[model samples]
Target: MTDTSIEPSADAPAQLSTLDRFLPVWIGAAMLIGIVLGKAIPDLDETLDAIKIDTVSLPIAIGLLAMMYPVLAKVKYTRIGESLDRRSLVMSLVLNWLIGPALMFALAWILLPDLPEYRTGLIIVGLARCIAMVLIWNDLACGSRELAAVLVAINSLFQIVAYSILGYFYLELLPEWLGLDSDGIDVTMWEIAKSVLIFLGIPLLAGFLTRTIGERAKGVEWYEERFLPRIGPVALYGLLFTIVILFALQGEQITEQPWDVARIAVPLLIYFALMWFGSYFAGLKMGFPYERNTSIAFTAAGNNFELAIAVSIGVFGVTSGQALAGVVGPLIEVPVLVALVYVSLWAKRRYYDTDGVRPRS
Candidate 1:
């Protein structure tokens, strides 16, 4: 589903279908629509391409910014210091950056050994950890919004450094070790840094300012109860719009060989499911309660695909396999995470303690 918070939108309808509950149908429809348009309007990318400055597409950049601003606006800054549940934070970091990346490295090599572009694209996706939308998934599962918010705050900054270093290491050096071709896939650390700065850094600052000023002026209650709800759906709607343009640009590439899209999606599906289960069980074994554990699970399982796609397009070309893979990310992620959302809900009731209390180790 869309990555908006579980907080009900100010203007939401009371009833939501299974399709409405998750974003797969909507996101998938967007993908198909983009693809169809791409096929129908073979020159669509060119038309969009005309409205660009330097390498960055103005429309795409704005679309990407719109997707993240709402999520950033809701960061509970006070919790940045107070929400340090040491056990939960450490586990999330390990699963997200360390184990998760290693798992992706293995999967990418095994699954996409030959296709370096697609393989590198998947690895880039792994390097960029979830910041914004996992908050949405975490909230939906009745997890700690504060913990989710704090982790996002931490990861948003961490990604600036970690993504570039890891991107270089995995996308560059890892291939050297495996003896795979490392030719045109040389997207340097700086390239990623630039994209992260524009895509993530701006939103983080804006979100922080929005929260700090809004709370100070309008009062915390109004900011949370009224302002947050109004902007809540922006990220979701932005995501759909970005997808249309992405698939439209990627149309020829996608239509020429549709199976490549499926191939790239394979590792992403495995990563999301495995990481979620791994984090969930790890939390239980470590004795964190259900709410805290779900926060850890979703944070580890979800990805910052907005950053991934932007970096891929900036570093790799818009029509490059890497960018295409980045676009395909949400197509797979929304559904997989939605299923896991249900799975987490089931586990919340059947497997986890409803009271969300566990003894310290």
Candidate 2:
């Protein structure tokens, strides 16, 4: 496979169609629609929540699968090994595991000191890491496709082992060590692992198979130019669909408790800015090219809202404040990450050379 991982072909914003360029608007509209639908229809949440695939709602699982498949299919899987950089991988691991969770823990405590449930929910969000939408954000920012694939793969496998342990530490032990009050959280490792396998594993396998079969039947050019574009729009549709469903399920809570949602959103905004900018600059300091650096930034910044919400609802009741906090995760993340995609493009122009390397000042 040819290595086009060094530089983005064109500035992302310029290359995007009108629909994609106005992604934030579309997302906002979806959120509003979901909220209206949820509020207007009695028992909408209960109805949506009726069907379940393990711990997650079946509609959500379907949306997640749809949201993930096209993006993963766009990855050039064959080149992931060839383009792998140990340094980038190490940085991603540290950001996702150590710095990311600790930052959320601190922010939650600092910002929402009086609200323990919300704090715990934010901490859970941090531990979950990004498996789903990072691919979309990374692709939108014109980041390295193969590197995003590799990092996401690493995160999925690592979360299966680390989520429960980290949950215990963050929720129970860390607070105790700090002489603070916290309730012990019971998180099943198998449930979390099952979620990862379903949400990520199924789509990943499908994406890989699609590419393998598609490429074998048709040439790479035909697949990349023709088939990929035809399917590309599905990703946006899936994303919009997921957002609508998520907001619909939690709409009453969000609209009713606007102030609380704002409170939850503040620390989340801080977390995304800190993670994305911090990771980007760290990669720049390490002399990484823009493509790899973007992958690092987005992968670090995004969290697995699906896993966090599932864990929260399973641990706390569906209407618990903790669950509301978990729902707020994507509500804040969507618009923010969409903005960062543009910001990444801006940084690319101002900071990076044509070859995607930031010149040494």
Candidate 3:
């Protein structure tokens, strides 16, 4: 059996490279730089808008593809079917699909009742569940790589099916059912599905093929250590590039409407806390091992911001408040989830023994 557990270390942050360590800083810098460029260049948005692939800006689409590829490639496709019987997997599905989105819908409506576009954008973020960086967060907390990999693959597959359905439910049907006013998404379910197919399906297939072929030709060690390391940094570069272009497109709106950004953040902050802590303690009560618990918690808490950004831009124009709300997701998520790594560690010590087994109360 593949050893799925990450070896625990004293410094979880030390497990990360400097680039990952200062990710939020880099993203902030990218935003500032993009804003500066937008302010400097009078026709930046027009230039970006000139080219499009299925309603997404060509430049942003390129960046989104770049950002998603390496991360998906890191998933262990071979390990997917290994341990499907575990209760943790079922629990994770419930948290990710049912609870997570419903909570976001409630919070977005409750907190931003006046701002429909931003509200719709946050709902999209909630639906685009974690398939990317939760692996890093899980590993950082010394969680189960085997479970994380399997869970990610399952979530990735589930995304292609559930995202559009959930999008319609929350964005259109739910509001009308409850007598709440909604602008309603202009795009058809097919339009949303097409976006998902392009942005997520393409990268997911590429990543799976890359790993499968690379491992077959070169063996797992070289494929993982050498090739993956070389291409891994490309994900960060792509994310920053996308952010820069996104901010450049909406620099004036973001700068002029700073309070609007702040309002979007409040619901996100509450959502992250509620999901992470709620999942963690729920795992504890269910008597999950520490590693699996950590894995479930992070997986449940994180959002696929890359997919969210892509879909928002695809369905709503790049300049819309919906896209801006999607962009703000990672900006808030990165820092908040990073802090939760320490919180996970602290919970382990507080509730579980050194062997990662919880004590009976």
Best by lDDT: 2
Ranking by TM-score: 2, 1, 3
Could you tell me which 10 consecutive residues in candidate 3 have the lowest summed lDDT?
Answer: 1-10
**Model 3 agreement with the true structure over 314-353: per-residue lDDT tens digits:** 6777788898898788768877887898788778777887
Candidate number that wins on TM-score, 1 or 2: 2
Minimum summed lDDT over a 10-residue window in model 2 is located at 1-10
For residues 1-361, write the lDDT of model 2, one tens digit per residue: 1112223644546667777878899999999999998888888987888789656789888888888898888888888996678899899999999999999999999999999989988998999999999999988888888899999989999999999999899888999999998866788779888999999999999999999999999989888888888887788888889888888888898889999999999999999999999999988888998889999999999999999988888898777888899989999999999999989988887787876766445
Q: What C-alpha lDDT, on a 0 to 100 scale, does residue 163 get in candidate 1?
A: 74
**lDDT (C-alpha) at residue 25 in model 3:** 82
RMSD each, Å: 4.0, 2.4, 3.6
Cα miss at 175, model 3 (Å)?
2.6
Score every model by TM-score: 0.84, 0.96, 0.84
What are the runs in model 1 whose C-alpha is more than 4 Å off? 1-22, 358-361
The candidate that achieves the highest TM-score relative to the unseen native structure:
2
